[model samples]
Target: MAYTLHNLPAKLEASKMATLGYARVSTQDQHLTGQLEALKAAGAETIYREKISGARADRPQLAKLMAALQPGDTVIVTKLDRLGRSTRELLDLIQRIGDARASFRSLGDPLWDTSSSQGRLLSTLLAAIAEFERDLIRERTGDGRKRAMADGIKFGRKPKLSDFQRAEAIKRRAAGETLGAIAKSYAVDISTISRLRA
Candidate 1:
């Protein structure tokens, strides 16, 4: 390669162009293929697909798509729910896209695009409502957990060992044996054995 400013014209980097498509499904039986087909019909240059719970936040594929977005580009999804299980997260993602100088379009909902005045207004209003709902859920969940704790209702998974099993485990531990060996015999964790001894 030779730097020739005399005869050859100076080359400039091309402007960024991007249109990403996102598809999601709630179950194994719910095929994402239909969403993909619809996205393609909507003229998406790239596609991202995933199978996860709507309530899950750690979607690696969605993160990748967001990272790859460019200014003047768009993020297209079959629907708003496909973008997120949480209302606030969905609103945050759309806001981020706007901050990135990009846009969002939904195949199902006509209010996503900011082209029309009504569409733009609806987008902002809906995003606000979603954010409010998410906050309310968080507050309610915290309050409910606190109430349950006061009422002596334990949250999360229950202990697998009964009081009788715990007594037997204590006896086994007192008889001289490795916790691992005891656990192997009973098919339980060493921590479980330690708790029993305690």
Candidate 2:
């Protein structure tokens, strides 16, 4: 059954409810000025800002912000990606907020708000799209690797020592030459020379 705003939980008053904003940047070099301003304009009473990669699971400020949420409070972000780097994480966060009786909103994606029935529907649709995108990327990458393998193309770093160089090194070592001498002569690391024996 489709959820309606009227059938669900009572609508909380905007004045009585607190809107907590979260702003994130991928690197320390990036600035959070624009997001901060937007959050402030959106009436965020308390803002949590971070300059850490979204791919990283450890976000101290985000943790603290979520912990501080109370029933009827709303969590707001400038964009969906600011909340999570992956679709799974995004869905998990939304679920967590909902379980806490708090709402979630994204200023960039207006439909992402969980304050109404329509917004909730849009969030589900968006999550499906994100999953579809990730699947497409994985398929394309696998196909590309298979194609490259068929073309006799190498994937990783080139060997530092050629096969012929390795044979010569082994022969020289058998003749009582030191591993360091062989490594120095071949312009490679001692570990490279040692690895040839194994």
Point to the candidate with the largest TM-score.
2
Best by lDDT: 2
Model 1: runs farther than 4 Å from truth?
1-16, 130-198
Q: Candidate 2, residues 1-198: lDDT per residue as tens digits?
A: 111112223454333677889999999899998988898888886788889999898999899888878899999999999998877899989989988899999999988889999988877887788789889999999999999999999899999998899899999988989999999998999999988862
Per-model tally of clashing residue pairs: 0, 0
Global Cα lDDT for candidate 1: 0.78
Candidate 1: the clashing residue pairs are: none
lDDT of each: 0.78, 0.85
RMSD of 1: 8.7
